[model samples]
Target: PSRTEGNTRLYTDEDLQRLEFILNLARDLGVNISGIAIILQMRERMEEMQRQIHDFVQYIQEEVLSRATAATDASRGAIVPVRRPMVTPASQNTRKK
Candidate 1:
């Protein structure tokens, strides 16, 4: 927080958004300062993990495609994309029972 000549703290858009988020956690969710701190830390960690997972998946996909292309001969057809099987909600429910 930076102060102006009038001694008023100037808040940026990002700072305002963070303040609003903290207020919501305190007023709406009834989370105290310590709890809010913990929640924010966990959220940051989860976001970091998600980013790492996405990078790893991308790297693996690129490596596999490159290797496949190198291994294929002129007689063999070009690399074919493999489609993953989609699991619908109905299939999930059946498995549960």
Candidate 2:
């Protein structure tokens, strides 16, 4: 909480939410201030970990897509010709027998 020229306290949305959470923990769950502090720290850490994992997954996906596109573009003009072995009339007659 910050004070203005008139000494009035101002609370942001995040501040209000944190105040509400602390109040709930103390009033409803009987959590001490120390316990609440630890819980808040752990929650923040978990959120940070989630963000890191999401970022890593996004990076991998982008890399894979770019590489696949490059491979496709590089092979676009590549042509492979397949040749079948010539069959003679004598070979055909032997197969029929």
Candidate 3:
């Protein structure tokens, strides 16, 4: 109901908190405004990923920790990734078969 405003919905306190969180994240990461917009678009995706990580930790705790409790996972099941070459724009284009 922000009719006096020029075509922008006034954000509530909770919305401000969310926007603040996104802005803080962007600031901490040194991301640009456009990048921040992209991050906001994927905000729900980021939240989902965090939730999944929490669920996975709980699973590992119930299954692994219960069987053999440790100070931490340590070297029990660690993952190491290999580096890959950057994708060139020419290669990035998806071609139809």
Candidate 4:
């Protein structure tokens, strides 16, 4: 519930959703008010942690892309030779009969 200019209580969609969840918890799950509050708090914390993780991953991706672009630009027009591992044929003694 929020206070209007006239000091009347105004419930937003989020408020209504929270009220519904609380009602469901009490009626369906038989959870007490304290338990409901604790569950809500934990849910909020978990959501926040998830958001932080997503943001961190995005940051890492951006950093990696920027570094790769910088490296490509710096190495432009450079012919870098690729070296392959040398393979030697096995001797008759080492070969299976």
Candidate 5:
């Protein structure tokens, strides 16, 4: 709304408060809206990168665990003997001819 008594237009109290906030942010805090937006974007990118790294690490760990388990089972199957029979040596050699 504007008053017809003067040529210049006046702003409402809410507009003044918002303008003051923007001015203080630029002047007092030495921060601009562009810089703040860039910072937020960079932070979001960093978080995404971190999540990807974590997922890769977990995939590598699972792969390593699966390989280890398969290797253990193969080794167990390929092993020659884990126990021996209680038999006399003379008796064992007698059947070999």
Candidate 6:
């Protein structure tokens, strides 16, 4: 609910939708006012958590892409030599009794 210039409460489309949701919870779902409040609070918290997760994912993606680009550019003219370790074969002789 918002206040107007005449000190009257104004309901927007979003407000109406929320009111409808609350009414549905009370009438159809047989939820009490306190239960409805709890449900709404939980819903808001979940939505906030979801938003944070989305932001974190976006940040990680950007960081990864930036690091990859920097690594590619830094290695453009560099020569990295690869070496493999030599392994010796085990002797097949067994101890005699």
Model 2 RMSD to the real structure?
Answer: 3.0
What TM-score against the true fold does each predicted structure earn? 0.60, 0.77, 0.36, 0.73, 0.52, 0.75
Worst 10 contiguous positions by lDDT, candidate 5? 35-44
Please tell me which model should have the higher TM-score, number 2 or number 4.
2
Error of 4 at 57 (Å): 1.4
Candidate 1 clash pair list:
none
**What is the lDDT of every predicted structure here?**
0.91, 0.95, 0.77, 0.95, 0.81, 0.95
**Which window of 10 residues has the lowest lDDT sum in candidate 2?**
87-96
Candidate 1 TM-score, true structure as reference: 0.60
On TM-score, the stronger of 4 and 6 is 6
All candidates in order of TM-score, best leading: 2, 6, 4, 1, 5, 3
State model 6's lDDT: 0.95
In Å, residue 24's CA in model 5 sits off its true spot by 12
lDDT value for model 5: 0.81
Q: Give the TM-score of candidate 5.
A: 0.52
Residue by residue across 15-94, what tens digits does model 6's lDDT show?
A: 99999999999999999999999999999999999999999999999999999999999999899898888897656664
* Inter-residue clash pairs, candidate 5: none
Q: What's model 2's lDDT at 28?
A: 99
The sequence of per-residue lDDT tens digits that candidate 4 reaches over residues 1-97 is 7798999999999999988999999999999989998999998999999999999999999999999999999999999899999999899988767
lDDT of 5 at 52: 100
The residue-by-residue lDDT of candidate 1 on 6-85, one tens digit each, is: 99999999889888999999999999999999998998899999999999999999999988887775538777789999
Question: What local lDDT does model 1 show for residue 76?
Answer: 82
lDDT for model 1 comes to 0.91
Candidate topping TM-score: 2
